[model samples]
Target: MKLGTLVKPLLITGLIIAGPAMAAPSAQQVLAASPVDDIVERYPAMMSEGIREGLKRSPQLPPMVADTIGYVVSNSFRAADIEQQIVKNLERDLSGKQLEAVEGWYKTPVARKISAVEIAASDPAAWQQMQAKAAELGKKYKGTDRARMFERFDRAARATESAVDTTIAVQLGLATAMAAFSPDSANYDELKRKIENQRNAIRGVVEQQVYDSYLHTYEKISMQEMGLYIDFLESGPGSAFSKTVTQSIQQAITDPIESIGNQMARFLAPQK
Candidate 1:
């Protein structure tokens, strides 16, 4: 439903599809074809100022300390290693052909164009621009058509769901990290309860972001190019590729949160 992974800073960020197999892609081939690299490289977008923002919530924390967290998030977040990890993870489930197909689609002029848009969207300028366009697109799809456009993207890369999953994963990650980071500051159980309680609200937030992000990413892409991407998403291999990558990203996000919990437990443990 969402990436809903608790990633590290402990905060961050799955999918589905299936079919009979041709030869699956080799690890190298999959890596060569898939957009995992680009996604990894662009990951800073998912993280900008978040670690610091979360730290700001702590009244006892000093600004310098908060800045340290921000530095780790913005400067030292190891997205490339995580990307390598994701490539390995997705390769476990996806076939060569499937991976190749996904790579092929992304390699097309339209998909490359979309890639450029996505890279830009990860930054403040592009997001601002996309936000404006999403508003316009929202207007264009108003009333009964508003509901229809939500349905409109089911086949088009399932862009909406993918966006929601990524956003949720990040939130879950941040909440998880916050709980561990402040284990002694509040009742951990109560904090986790609050996180669970807000899941739906968070989902609503992610949904809107997805809607805006899709419009934002596709702003420069021609309708014809957009249509091709949609067709690829609907295809058997493409669908699997999307699912595998989404799942891989979720797992990548999930691992750091788990590590934070374990690490925190040790950090708080009595020194025997």
Candidate 2:
């Protein structure tokens, strides 16, 4: 037939064929679409509050020692530093389609609502409220379908897993700080093993804490909203994004602590 008609068809076919080769969302674009950066930005302050509470519980902990640990944690778990590392890891791990899908989901209305709740819950005051009302909330949700659904959501979101990783990271930071004052510093492996040996115990605590926190955080979010969020998390791209972010966060926090023992030791050392 006509030359113009033939060229139009060819152009359409070429575009269709090239669609899959289009550039994926950049790491910053994906992060910007998600709540990850916001959540990470609050980490240092949250950690400081956690340490303060923990120190309160540890009446035996010397003030100087507590101060040292605080200093180390504050310096070591910088939000910008962690976010930069997470971007690097996500860049390496996420596929173009996966990143695009994750960005799409995070941009949704439901995700925005849930993300707001999560960000608010990340606050120290929110944590304190959750802790204070944990027992009451646990009883209210117990034996209900809501609780069951929450379990599924938690599993999909890797909530407990991430919490455990955070617990381990905090412990590792403390150990690294303590090592600074010790005569013989434990190597990374030894410190890791020592921390990991308590993983089961740590998981038990984090599991309950995560559950309670979820209940409190999502209390305002309707069941339908939570269900939609869960569906996203269970999807292939969602699962991958959840897993990648969790691992990236763990690495960002731990990588510095792994070698921080030496630096902290030197910093805490007496002037020569």
Best candidate per lDDT, number?
2
Model 2 weakest lDDT span, ten residues long: 52-61
Counted clashes in each candidate structure = 15, 0
The TM-scores, one per candidate, come to 0.70, 0.83
**For model 1, how does the per-residue alpha-carbon lDDT over 96-169 read when each residue is reduced to its tens digit?**
66666776777777777766666666665565667667777777656643335445565445565655555554
**Can you give the lDDT of residue 232 in candidate 2?**
89
Candidate 2 lDDT, 155-232, residue by residue in tens: 899999888988887777566655655678786679879999999999999898888988899999999999989998
lDDT of candidate 2 at residue 264, scale 0 to 100: 55
- In model 2, pairs of residues that clash are none
Model 2 ranges with Cα > 4 A deviation? 1-24, 179-188, 265-272
